[model samples]
Target: MSTERRAPLDRKRVADTALKLLNEVGLEGLTLRAIAKELDVKAPALYWHFKDKQALLDEMATEMYRRMVASAALDPADSWQERMLKANRGLRAALLSYRDGARVYSGSRFTGTDHAREMESNLRLFTASGFTLAQTVRANSTAYSYTIGFVIEEQGVKPLPGERREGYDVQERARLLAEFPLAAAAGAEIFEDYDRHFEEGLALIVAGVESWTRLG
Candidate 1:
């Protein structure tokens, strides 16, 4: 029997493994020891590539960012509203892909050149859409914050019984609906379809930016 051990590890390899682990175990369950086991290496071996788990997380965030931008290409023909909607939707989808994905990406610092380029491109897109520099910054920040905050709430620690955020607590919603018909009627539509709700919410933000550009 011949045992030649495994190949050497690199940063990308480590980050990739961490992503897989993230998908499998989620943020709370992800750890250096878990990644090491997946790679068939000692925990110390990961240190050669990543100084700590945070470094690995940064790499994972970068990788996620790269994938997001790649998939969210903007065409010159796209209107400002179109671009904004596309970008927000793409970001939400990417974050929802992995378990606790938003937590992972949101925690890491955006210091990479690729991240800078992505940010710059987005800023340019906003400016081209008639927003001032200051407005552009705020608009982008608001949209991003909204997306992250929504996802964090939406992804509530492993699929619950019903699996959707509003849909998850069916009993509570039903009780509320029975107690307050007027409020429940209005809230029911908002909670019924998450995709449509997200789009409508994003549209409201976009409309606010439009009003800002016009009135400012």
Candidate 2:
């Protein structure tokens, strides 16, 4: 029983509603009925634009990349590490904007033109710095791994579900800290130096790749 009227479906409109649904409900709760309700249309109307939910998601992923924060493309004249790090950080920050945004955005297999252009820029920088196309792709993958891994940690915010969250019991923390001094101390410092740690991880990958330079 398709209740949708005989009107044509615009894929972009469907995509916009899908993104809104993702932001409001997160990926787990996303559904075509929800989007249809939001758009004041029928679920079958959505089918005209997207053959299935997977098609809808693929389109939404591409749209998200285009709508993500605007970072100036990589500087080709910079060193390989410099250009790559800038792109990595920029992409991470863009995806960090929405709730559980990185979780949805990063996992999708997006091969849009915007991503292609960004990679071409990185390859130019790396090739200039003595890497073949294959080497550049390897380094690029490693850089991406560091950034997404870091963002996954940052995005996993497990606070109290409501306004009842005030502060944790310092005495309890202290007792736990006494029992596991090193782990507690490290955990406390994680809050203090997350940014520094992110850079260190990314730099390690970039520097490791640099060691493979063909120079004598």
Per-residue C-alpha lDDT of model 2 across residues 1-216, encoded as one tens digit per residue = 988674445877788777777757766778888898888887897887778777777777777777653545445568776777787777676656555566666667663465677666667777777788888888788888778777666656421122112334344555778878776666544543456877888888877887865442
Q: After superposing candidate 2, which stretches have Cα over 4 Å from the reference?
A: 1-9, 69-71, 111-114, 158-177, 191-193, 214-216
Per-model lDDT:
0.78, 0.69
Count: clashes, candidate 1: 0
Clashing pairs in 2: none
Q: Candidate 1, after superposition: displacement of residue 122 in Å?
A: 2.5
Deviation in angstroms for 61 in model 2?
2.2
TM-score for each of the candidates: 0.85, 0.78
Q: What lDDT would candidate 2 get against the real structure? A: 0.69
What C-alpha lDDT does candidate 1 achieve relative to the native structure? Answer: 0.78
